[model samples]
Target: MIHFFKQDVSHIALPEKFTYPFHYTPHPLCVLATGEVKEYIAGKKEWQEELATGKMFGVLVVQMPQSTDTGYLAAFSGNLAGKNIHSFFVPPVYDLLQPQGFFKIEEEQISAINQRIDELENSASYLKAKERQKVETAKAQATLNQAKAGLKAAKEARELRRQSSLALSEEEQAGLIRESQYQKAEYKRLEKEWKRQVEELEAEVTRFESEIERMKMERKERSAALQERLFEQFRMLNAKGEVKDLCTIFEETVHKLPPGGAGECALPKLLQYAYFHQLKPLAMAEFWWGDSPKNEVRHHGYYYPSCKGKCEPILQHMLQGLEVDDNPLLDNLHKDTKLEIVFEDEWLLVVNKPAGMLSVPGKADEVDSVYHHLKKLYPNATGPMIVHRLDMATSGLLLVAKTKEVHQHLQEQFEKRSIRKRYVALLDGSLSDIEKTGRISLPLCLNPLDRPRQMVSEEYGKEAITDYQIISVSNGHTRIAFFPLTGRTHQLRMHAAHPKGLGCPIAGDELYGKKAGRLYLHAEYIEFRHPIYGDIICIQKEAEF
Candidate 1:
């Protein structure tokens, strides 16, 4: 049963079998255990109309009976002056109608609701328009910037061409020459800027092409589509269509580009194309041929350079290398240590290698290396043999053999896994498992996507095992002792940082861990059988932590 009034707990007894209609929200109101009595605030027109029989602003008291489920519906039909007020007792009813006054209140409520909806719609529209405008504004700005650069370049180029023309009178020609030189300087500056832009574009293209090649080899159609989408924007910039003649156009455009002209050098453009195509073989050949070579051919066995004496002229005139040869890398490493020996003996030598020092010589920069250092130290020897390697960053315990026989013996021991190597590492997070010891059996494989990162894979991977124990923990850092079963490049370090394992990345491993500093892992101990003495030998150095 439903009752309507204002603020009373008492109920008058009423009969049943009567019904009335009422409007209500579908949401249920929580009925207090003690029963709540309140004025029925109606927002529906039918409810308001029912309540309007009485004065509009007067209060209606309600009673929620404590003893029964059904209660009386009474109407006190006049003001409190006792002016012929009518009293009525209605039977218990479930559907009650609203008074006329309540109906009017509902109509106004609906109008307010509609206004709110309109406001919300306007707000939504405004936000959408603002976002669209922002996007368009950014696009317009970018377009303007590009146009400005192109126009400036074109204007400068035209001016230079005009000045270079010989049709002007002598006085005018002198003025033109002066103007041309100034413009030429400006053009060179612009050319440098253009070169920088081209380099950036080339790098971007190279990365894109590398990704594409990787995707193609894996037969990833979706990846290829994504790659094409990224290139679409680039194609618009370059005014390119289809992939055919792309290299040729790029090369020609770059080549025809004068030093300060509106055009760019073709070398970068060609390199970018070759990088994208992974035409490394051809690219390498071109690079080896230097900037210019009159005649060059790659045959089955070797490369042939028949320059028609053009190469000699280039070497003499263009390169200016007649008196001295300059290698920039060597120039960068021009120090006494590059020539001085760290440690040398007739049998073996150890070197304190500075960073950027190669343990052995590469094909190109074959001048400065440990071999060079050793060669300089031992003039009578043929070539020093590198027994093991410490990466350019690692600065201690590099072993080299002077005699071929000794080198072969030392190499055999390393290859046979007869060396006991220990590394000290400062790792991320405090050591939780200081006494715990277990073998990490995850197989290691070089990352196909990023060659520099090694991944743990289940298939097509080689077995890698590292035994690590926490030595000490301090300052949220754990010093760990590492021993490897297999000598994989970056094996122990990679395994330690694996998320499922300890999750404590080695300090100084910027690629694998938070950039704390340099790589904190140091090879502090190496034990092996000595070649000359038929006994085991151990070498240890103080921690460089």
Candidate 2:
């Protein structure tokens, strides 16, 4: 059985139930473990050295049944020598240090093969061959140029002879003609020879390229086979002594092969250790500790949910008989609200959208959206009525086109940036005097591991700009008005949350800030020219909050 770390937690309030593994606030045990790990790392000289390199470390709080108390185990996602070897933490999912392991051998062999291929590509003989081809091409071009010059000279000579034919003998004229014919024949012969040489040189280069391609394909095949062997060795076992390889588990559950970083999480390591030791699983949580990655938002000492893309499928199989909470985010919350139409015309309609309703039908079958509701209300609507979309948590004025032509026109306006919009949000914290009015220029991209979550990442993100001014400030919160210059997924939420932008997330943003009753963002105003009417139309709706 796993041993629990002894600490005075008499005042700490333990959660009565486990957190929904998909998303929830971290349990008290997990938070305590995070604090302990932070303290431990700060005191260690080796850990300080490792932290300087920006390595990510994670901790998992688990309950061991045999110990009659909840304990925590820590592990790095990839590797950290000082942390991994610590007795207080669980062992790695796979120890890569074993010198005679098949993984190590396959890795070394593949590395050697890649090195050999690189050497062959840059060898002296290969470079010399390329230079020789270049020299031959230059010589052929020179010969072609000479042939053209000779042809031109022969034509000029023939023309002069023809003009002087009356003053010259027939023999001289015939000789001149013969010389011209000879030059033409020589030019044709030179052209043919040049073509032949060029073709031969091209064929030689093709052969060299083909040989290199063949070598690469051969190496790829070997590497693929080795990788398959490595994956097959990653077989996991359950408490019942039944075993299944990681590939089979993912395929049977998610109907696809396991993706990269599938079995490299803290949960897999902790669960595997529990199964082997016959310890009943009680609760588990994972937290991020270290520098945030360049492309993802991860603050040190923050608790994060397990990734959906990589871990969900694996955990579905691993936690076969264990009871878990249904994901609350998947529930349809738009059933009660009716579509509020603000304005209607022959060509278009503008409606007030409610928060918690989808802009369109999502992947889930039970989802109720503004588009689907409009289809029911206007059964004879000619085209896709929803011209644009607001985030599910944002309430606002939405434009709808009745005909395909009107839809196209409005879409064109949006693309041209002629349509104007304004949003209102209550931020969690106050802004300084200079920050009362400003624009935020930050790039954003989706966090693949956690769906719908946007992070500030300049390297791989799209440009998202937001203009804002303080509307009011009271009770440790500031109500701000926003003008979005560019549209991107979760642009406002991320901009509000990013430290470089506002340094405070919009209130009730579960992904970036603390969770509340609902997100405090509302699209309050919109203005655009009518497609058929040629008159400008403006609409406004007040937020219920």
Candidate 3:
């Protein structure tokens, strides 16, 4: 699967360390290799339409041992064109799709179980038994009801006869009471008989269902066991030649079990082959080559980091014993940015937060944040000084409270949605068909696999609404104003990039759009009530871009 480099690259310097897979700037060699792979895919017109649906491909630049030959390996996530054994791309760690593999053999048995379940569910005998049970139960209930009604009428008649007999003789009254007692005894007998009939009918139905239930239980157990065994077969390799299966690797992580499709990603396949063949890996990169997914924001040919949920633990094991670059997330992104105070009073202040600055202290031993800055400025400020937050990539106006009481009041206003916010952003693409004004109501939730990234999810997302007005369209870019009625994380970004909404990503939005000098979104205006003064207040800041 090694394709030797055709272009001369002797002048380019090699990286001092391996590219960190989780987050990276693609190396020059990797970029060259990715371009070649893309060219090959493009020439294959047979796969063009299917591949236009979207796929992830990766390249691993490796050095052949004791030789000057420098070639790269290519891999695609999962299978291409329904097969994992395609030429040029590396094979999977364990080909579960192989016809003779244990996974397939077990899968057939599971399929049989499923078929049997369907047969039993639709069997004539089972259906007939169910129908009979329903009908018989209804008949039994109706009989009991009719008997009770007859007994009630008989009692009424007995009472009338006794009342008339009171003027005649005591024996007559005694006879009427005896008749009432006999009628009650008959109703009791009929009720018991009907209950017995209903029980028999229910038992008949249970007899037909018992086998199907047992088969379903067996299917569940066998499927779970088969999946665990499949994980065991996927043994991974590290640069040191150490090995760990999927189960063992995931057990060491916070998620104690491997997620589905854990070992099939392009990153894992590339490294697995590199280690298996004794090649020394120097650099790697993964890029999306086709259509962007519905929920995520992806640009064609743009390089992206490996996912966290599936690849993080696997990469942690596979990358051992190699000199890798430190994670960039731990570094401060806005060390030179300074917070600008926009408005201030006895209780609170509004500051213009620069893009890339954190609203509060973050993990990875980062202590520089707006909250910490306020602490240094006020020194004696009480409670949490930071009243609200903005995405690190977004420049915005943030409210800061000086006292605990004031913070509570501001929080209450936010909860009641009395605080109004307006943002201005420049989209990377022009929206020729978009109306001048509109409302976008796409729901959003954090992508479980990728932290801090939001996705459009109608099923589990919280309601996020934005009203937008197109400001101007110029040079293939659209500038718009966003009035957010909800403050979910990344709500505005998701609404803008999602295909069902604006279908355009904001300029320089590294997570959703092409990376540039900075994100082109800004909180330009806000209106709120003063917490202490009980007076309406408004603030405005012009975007630098």
The local distance difference test score of each candidate is 0.46, 0.75, 0.88
Instruction: Kindly indicate the candidate among 1 and 2 with the higher TM-score.
Output: 2
* Better-scoring candidate (lDDT), 2 or 3: 3
lDDT of 1 at 104: 37
- Model 1 stretches with alpha carbons more than 4 Å out: 1-345, 352-356, 362-368, 379-384, 433-435
Name the 10 consecutive residues with the lowest summed lDDT in model 2.
53-62
Ranking, lDDT, top scorer first: 3, 2, 1
* Residue-level lDDT tens digits of model 3 in 1-545: 99987789887788889999876778899989999999988998988887888888999999898876678999999888888888879999999989998999999999999999999899998899899889988898888889888988887877777676548477776777778788888888888888887888788888778888999999999998998999999899999899999999999978798988989999999999999998889999988877888878777887888888899899999999899998866668666557799999888999999887778888854646788778878999999888889987789899899999999999999999999999999999998786999999988898988776888887998999999999999999999999999999988888888778888989887677677778899999988899877999999999998
TM-scores for candidates 1 onward, in order: 0.40, 0.81, 0.94
Question: After superposition, which runs of candidate 2 have C-alpha atoms over 4 Å from their true positions?
Answer: 1-19, 49-61, 66-68, 81-86, 163-181, 184-215, 237-242, 249-257, 338-352, 372-382, 401-408, 427-450, 453-464, 469-479, 497-505, 542-545
Model 1, span 1-545: residue lDDT tens? 13332333334332121110011111111122112211232322443444333221111112232333322222221122222222321111111122343323544454455555455444654446545555655655575567568667766775776678867677875775676567657656765665565555556445545544554444444434433332232221111212322222223332321111111111222222322332220111110111111111111111121121111111122112112223333443623565333455567665545544667775656447776676766776544477887654444556677788878888888888888888777887786754566667767777543334567777766888888877878898888888877877567667777654566667755445543435677777777676787667666664656
Candidate 1 Cα deviation (angstroms), residue 189? 91
Could you give candidate 2's per-residue lDDT for residues 348-434 as a string of tens digits?
A: 998888878888888885888998888888888888889999888778889999888999999999989899999999998776555
Give the CA lDDT, 0 to 100, for residue 256 in model 2.
62
The root-mean-square deviation over C-alpha atoms between each candidate and the true structure, in angstroms, is: 36.8, 4.2, 2.1
